[model samples]
Target: MIDSHIHADTRPFEDFEAMAVSGIREAVTCAHDPLEMLSSDVVMAHFRRILKVDPHRAALNGLKLHTALGVHPRAIPHDYMKVLEELPELLSDPSVVAVGEIGLDSGSETEMNVFIEQLRIADETDRRVIVHTPRSGKEEITPLIADLLSQHIDERRAVIEHVNMDVIPLLIESDFMLGLTVQPEKLTPQEAVQILKEYGTDRFVLNSDMSSSPSDPLSVPRTVHRMRISGFGEGDIMRVSEKNIRKFLKIKN
Candidate 1:
């Protein structure tokens, strides 16, 4: 199964090594670097290292990797315009499946401006996007993002993460894909299964959102297990856990 969204680059190397063996067939490792925290070269180097997948090392774990390259809202530096300017070239890498983990956190004007421009870049590059919605202001920010996205790009090409029950309808109305993050601070696996039960799984995907936090690396597999116990059918499970993400990334298998 594919872990559609995970900050694999932010975790300790040993943790990531262990995670690669934990039943995740593949992972979309979103960039967690706020450009200011690391030079563009340094960040790209990290992706290179992550994607290297030493044949011998990968033989042990059996995990293939993909990447998303963009500035996270919290990681946005003071000279964010400079960062955005560099993104087009950086995002051109073949291993990058999307332009994201990018969007507003506190609804700062600066973050909004940067988020909108990144959406434009994603469109221009013909890559899908992974957006981060604010934790507290879903009602306000979700539609704001929806409006901005409608102006610049196709909502179907974007997957907005961190969605909860309240924001689900708003994003659905806007025609954006929904992501449920399973972790300690965010929603749990059981809650996600219940949401899937209510809404169905056609436009939904599950993620661990496991970054530097104390979140579990096995979150997605555990969620799959929980989903089975909840009586979710295999086809529905495949839709949310695997097929939906592959469709979003435009992957064949």
Candidate 2:
């Protein structure tokens, strides 16, 4: 199985081993702000760690780690345009799969600009995107995000992450895939499984979104187990846990 979104840099090495044991063969660790005062240099270092360091760490624990690089809205620094200027080159790295963890947090004008810019870069570069939708104001902010996305890039090129029941209807009919994150603050395993049952697994993928905050590293595999016990078919389980994300990220393996 593959965790479509995660923050492996913030996790202990043992979590990777536990994830491996839980049947996660691969994961995509996205760039996020780890500091209170972020800078262009800090963002670059964070990107490098996910691109270079985390892969080695995951490999050592018997998992393959892929990465996504972007300026998360919550983490954007004053010199964020500098990071944007350097993004295209960093995204060229083979281990980098998408331009993501990017999107609106506070609905600020700056967040809107940065979100649109990254979407443009992803579109121009033909990379996939993982757009974030914050838990707060998701209902109000999601439609705005959908509007911006419709204007900037192809819907097939992105997944709107951290979607709940309310946000699902906004993108359910669109070409963009929906990411169901299983965390303490996000959907529980049962709720995620119920979503797959109600909506079908065709356009849905599962993720942990695990970071330094309260999260379950084994969320994906645990959810897979839930699906099995819930009598979901093998094909459906595969679609949500692995196949959909592989196709979304264009991952060969």
Reference-based lDDT, each prediction: 0.79, 0.92
- TM-scores, in order shown? 0.89, 0.98
Locate the minimum summed-lDDT window of 10 residues in model 2.
32-41
For candidate 2, lDDT tens digit of each residue in 1-253?
A: 9999999889999999999998999999998767753678888888778888889999999999988999999989889999999999988999999998899988999999999999999998999999999889999999999999999999999899999999888789999999999999889999999998899999999999999889999999889999999999999999999999999898997
Query: What would the TM-score be for candidate 1 when compared with the true structure?
Result: 0.89
Clashes of each: 0, 0
Question: Which runs of model 2 end up more than 4 angstroms from their true locations?
Answer: none
Residue pairs in steric clash, candidate 2?
none
Query: Which candidate comes out best when scored by lDDT?
Result: 2
Tens digits of per-residue lDDT for model 1, 88-158: 98777777789888887888898888888899899999999998887687788888877787888998999
